[model samples]
Target: MLAELINPYYLQVASFILINIILGVSIYITLSTGQLSLANAGFMGIGAYTSALLTLNFDLPIIGGILAGTLLAGVFGILIGIPTLRLQGVYLAIVTLGFGEVIRVIFVNWESMTKGAVGLSGIPHMGRELLNTLKEFGFDPKILGLQNNQFVFLAIFLILLGVTISIITFFRRQNRSRVGRAFAAIKLDEKAAESMGINITYYKVLAFAQGALVAGFAGALFAHVLAYISPADFAYHRAVEILIFAVFGGSEVIWGPVFGALFLTVMPEVLRFISEYRYMIYGLIIIIMMAVRPQGLIDVNILNWLKLKTSKRRQKHGTSSQKSM
Candidate 1:
């Protein structure tokens, strides 16, 4: 696993997995609050555009660009959440879906700023400078036979790992906190949650804002890594893609989407042999899986099993250490 972390090819795939995990978690935030929001991709577009423009025009540092993007998108999330979160079920999904389309159209028609469908290019890669810094500090790349890109990949991987861990820890804490309990109540039953003194509106809006923050940060990182983006990139189709990441991954559990995104992101590549029928095969597989197990691949049972396995392993290791002593 350590050896593969520095492999450039695998690193690229890993980057996709990380980004998708972030996106999945973003939606999971809303779903946790019993809100069905499909506007994540729209918020992501806002972040990508904001960060890309800041870096391109104002000469802002990549981190500054990302921060600005995240803040701006959170504001947008609050704005959108105010009206849309009031709706429920398919209606809410439709309105949010429309919002995504509206954002995409604005990006397309606002040619003066977005360059329309021509797409932004020449965006800087976020970790390139870190690699240069490592070299300047007397680190010998030749010692490991690693190229500059590999170093860049390692930097990105570590940064993303930190981000993922921090976010996951924060979310897990939320799951145990008062807010998380309120979210659970609302999700299980809104009227009942309201009766119990939970402010449904406030919590729903907070969920939207939280989700947007994550999506925006992911988008900023995405723009920097890919070095290009366009209006079409944030279309309704993109919104649906992100939704698939959440739903197919088992939105019930925090880690489910990560698993789903990782598998789905790599599955197509693995099925590339039958290029023409790859998507057909993929769709068929999803249909079969949904039919057999609609709750998704990850659920309470699997999570518990994993936890139990880890605990046993730890106990065994502790016993060995004590005996050796």
Candidate 2:
């Protein structure tokens, strides 16, 4: 069993884990800020299609292609977020779902750029091309300008994942900042906060844009890692799966999505021949989990809830003691 996992195919699974981890965390962004975004699939599609087309047509490097994709996706996010994030609960969910569908239709119709339903073909391979990625590292061109693709791909993934983790951690800390307070205020009580002069729209939009950026980046990474991406890869179902894992993990925290993504991505592969029954078992597990722990299977929310309850109980006891005295 261990030997099979050590094989080359395992590399693909590892990459899959990385991709889902990004997706999960990206969804975590809006979720933490109290927004439920279903448009992650659209953002992912935007990044995948953008990066793939850029590399294939312009012969650009991975970094440049990814940057271009991220920029475009962010712009689209700003446009959608400006108007949509204000809606909360099922209303916001429906709006985001519509947004995802719109992107899907565009991908299907934009044959010149996306190749429509037939899907883009003959896209450049990530192998030797991936090796050329060292140019971004300021590595000595004289020695290892062209490392093996396998080695380079893994290195780049690690570097990118590290950078991503750092960014998320930084953002999590900012939750204590004024801006974070604004988001928390809005999330907790929009009407009260708005009455007090907080511009709920701006904070919601920021959360939306941040989530889109991460999803786009995830799409770009998956594209370059696999060297092939299609509309099928970013379908609405995929977006739902990302959101499900985010909630099932713990959107209240940052790394929950990462853990959720890793767990869910590997679960199916382990089922092997029972793959046909995989999602069934997976669904049952999620249902059972939610029944027991609706907050999340691995939620840290319990501590906060217990603290609140204990403090209230102590206050009540103190009041009774004072009255008796």
Candidate 3:
């Protein structure tokens, strides 16, 4: 009766929210360097297919597959970044977009490996695998009342979310370090950054590679969590959605993308009552947000103002208590 009262689908949605948060952070890392590359979806596809195949064929552990996928994507990022990172603005976007399409096409045509457009199924579930592994080590989940697969999955995702956030927090702090300043300088002005002894090419490529690595990690998790994948999963619009998460949330701070991902992922579900018009409303919200708060839903200025307001409120409350005394 207790289990029936709770919605299993909500847990699934929560898992997706966590996945999207990782995706949002991935693109923000690239955007931080001012490169408008759109190849994250491609990197994601590479990670998904690579990890899926490795696990399916070789019985590789989930962690092994994820690491393999991430490293492979990073290598591709470096290769693609070397030539394409030189371009700025829309030109880079166009190239990366093309790269994404090319990857989809490859996935579609590689029937022997990817099974063509039919997609791959029966990919190992991370939760199930972990559970089995634990059982092998004589550990029982029932001891903690986590015998349910859904709860196990949620637990794993929460751990991954926590770890990913910690890494992003570390990266955020790096913004004040020398490398962070170099990234900032390059974003501000490539020529000026180059003149300041900053290696524009190296830092730009580094940012791009890091973004790909992160996206690949997210993709690996996405594949296992859902246990199926297709070329369509990494389509052009998917890349656009990831970009919107960063833009709408305000990429100036790492938390901006995280907030953006959470809001956008949940908004549709919350508006399910108006399913037909939900998309229209969604479009309008984006248009309005772009028009009104071009800096995003969060930024340095907003954070500072929020801190000021909070401090002032605390001071006012203290003064009132003192007056009463």
Candidate 4:
């Protein structure tokens, strides 16, 4: 049972979970500012294609591709944000949804570059590429019993997940800062926020661009993990999936989306026994969640309650220790 759990397929699934976590956090950034942008998947496609092309055609290192892809996506985000941030509610969503379709169309038509719907395959795997580079630098993995490609991939995924979480922690901290307050104010009441001397446009655009950058980073990792990507991978449905990750988890806090992504990503695998009705059950679960807890599985109230419990436990433990002393 232990060996089965450690199999390559399971390792790959774990890598995918990490990728979805990044995606969830990315959408959470935009949702934090009350912007319902559906263009994240488009930005993701941009990152995936850019990285794949750079690595496959220009022979760029995986790290270099990742950075380039991330930055380019940010640039596109800024461009898109500036013009579209003026629109509110469904107007903004419709525009962004159109933007995603436009990106998909470009991917499909730009056959010379994107290979159209067929996708660009044979993109170098990050783990394999890193191992080869290490070998070149005289660091042999075979000596460490890391010869299996899956093990190497797992190691890389863990490192990336840690780094991603650390970065998210920083963002969470920033949420408590002035910028975060501004986001909250805007979310609560945009007119009031502006009346309070907040530059609504700047903050809105900033949030959108940040979300794009994060989504792009996730996409770069995703491309290498799958070693292939197509236009269909970043279509409207993909955008909805990313949104669900944030909405299902609760966008009030960063960890909400993380938990959402973790649960949703793994839930299907755990329910594979009922393969015929898996999707039906999945949809039912979501509908139930939406009806029961529209705010999400986690919210401010839950966090506060948990904090209170922890503090009470600590106080009790302190009193017991003092009495024993």
Candidate 5:
């Protein structure tokens, strides 16, 4: 694993985790709002296909392609959510699952561009080739960027990482805001939240849309990071994996998903001996983790924080009682 530390493959792995972080965070938005969403994978597929088609067919700039991919996915997400978010529980999952299937079929049969199930190739590498090409064009790789692939990859990785961190920090703050409380109440009881004047449809669709949008962002990032893509990559299993990470990380905690993404992305590489059975083992481990720490790794790690909060509250209560005495 240490040998891979400086490899471009490591950048590939880091990119995977980064994309998953976005995907996981998107799921967090929905689950935190008390809705189980499944269309995230579909959005990811949309982003991948969108960016690939744009850059490959039209020769669009990499950045432009990524943006277009994200926007297109967000649009599709909003459209799909409008009708499906109204359904509750398993119904929503079924709806999103169906959407994912539809996307897979579209990418498979659309051979004119997507190469029909063969997946897209010759994709522009937004991370590696882009950096190298920039350097070759006489740009000062140092004043402009790094000549080393590792350093360049790290620079781009930092940019993606920063965006993710900023978004998480934003949401963490929002968790204490009025909208966050409303979403929480809605999650606790949709009917009761509506009774209390919350707009159920608005929040529900917003949750799904937000999740889809971020998944799309991750999808675009994934496309550029790998410089190649295939329909198999975004299959139902991919959706399930994202869900597993969200749950395994404690969907409610912002940092939990990040750890989940990182661990899962690197776990198979670490367990190289069981490469063939890695996925199966991943499933087994997820099952065990869920059974053992259902709230997620973050919850387990922050036991001290919870204890501190409880102790402070108890002390405050005791002081109030003493004053009464």
Candidate 6:
């Protein structure tokens, strides 16, 4: 384990965790509004394939490709949301799942561009220009003593970390707004929320669109990090994994899904020694956790515990200050 920590592969896994966290958070966005969207993987595939093709064919900047992909995904997300968001529960999930399969089939059949399951290769490095720009500013990235890929992963991880923090902060603030209340009300009972004049469909679509934006951005990052992508990489199984992260992480908490992603991404690697048994073990652990804490690993009880601890510390500090005065 210590050796692995020192190796570059560890950094690669860390980057993977960051990417998964972003995907999990994307699902959480829609989950917050009581919508179950399984088409996140489709949006991700759209972003990856679109960005890769743009950069590969048009010689566009990698960042531009990523931005364009995200925009296109958001547009498509709204379109899909409009028609599908009307369905609720398992029916909605099935429709989104079908959409994901449709995307996979398209990628598999489009041999000329998508390479027909051969996947795209020789993807340009996203940080090539950025590294050159840094050199122009008299900064030597090589001085960091890391391989180019390692350095790129670390840089991407930091950038994504900032993005994650910003998203969490935004949602935390949103939770206090009227829109947040509407989401909560709708989640509790759509009929009651509609009685109060809240536009349920609008909020649902908005949440779904927001989720697509994040998932698309994450997909772009995944493509650049890997420099290779395949249709199967973003298939139904991958979508299910992202959903598991959201459910297991306590979607009600902004950071819960992030931690869930981190843990799940790392757990398999940690259990590498067990090989085949590891999966069974992992399944057992998840089953036990679900039975013990169905609310999730980081549910409201943990949040309330932390809040109480904070209040106690604040009270103690205030008492000390009063005594000193």
Best-fitting candidate, scored by TM-score: 4
Per-residue alpha-carbon lDDT of candidate 2 for residues 40-96, written as tens digits (9 for 90 to 100): 999998988898899899988767988888888888899999988657888999999
- Model 5 accuracy (lDDT, Cα): 0.80
- lDDT score for residue 37 of model 6: 90
Write model 6 residue lDDT over 1-325, tens digit each, in one string. 3332345577678778888988988998888888899999999999898899999999998889999888888888999999999899999999999998998999999998899888999887655556666779987756766655555556666776777678777777887888888888888899999999999999999888988988888888788878999999989998999998987887887677887898899999999999999998888877887898787788778989987787789788885332321
**Cα lDDT listed for each candidate:** 0.87, 0.77, 0.87, 0.88, 0.80, 0.84
Where does the lowest 10-residue lDDT sum fall in candidate 5? 316-325
Ranking by lDDT: 4, 3, 1, 6, 5, 2
Better of 1 and 6 by TM-score: 1
Top candidate when judged by lDDT against the true structure: 4
Candidate 5 lDDT, 229-265, residue by residue in tens: 8888888998898987877878666777777887888
- The 10-residue segment with the lowest total lDDT in model 4: 316-325
Q: What is the C-alpha RMSD of each candidate to the true structure, in Å?
A: 3.3, 8.2, 4.0, 3.4, 5.8, 3.8
Q: lDDT by residue for model 4 over 134-172, one digit each (tens)?
A: 779988756665555745776767767786778688788
Error of 4 at 123 (Å): 0.5
TM-score, cand. 1 vs. native = 0.92
Q: Write the per-residue lDDT of candidate 3 for residues 1-325, one digit (tens) a residue.
A: 4444435578777778888998998888888889887899999999999999999999999999999998998899999999998789999999999999999999999999999999999999887787777789988756665546755665666767686777678788878788888988988899999998999999999999999998998899889988999999999989999999999999988888888999999989888999799988888998999999988899998888997787789788885332321
Pairs clashing within candidate 2: none
> How many clashing pairs does model 3 include?
0
Taking the candidates one at a time, how many backbone clashes does each contain? 0, 0, 0, 0, 1, 0
Model 6 vs. true fold: TM: 0.90
What is the Cα-based TM-score of model 3?
0.92
For model 1, the run of ten residues with the poorest summed lDDT = 316-325
Q: Deviation in angstroms for 202 in model 5?
A: 1.0
**Once model 3 is optimally superposed onto the true structure by TM-score, how far is the C-alpha of residue 173 displaced, in angstroms?**
2.2
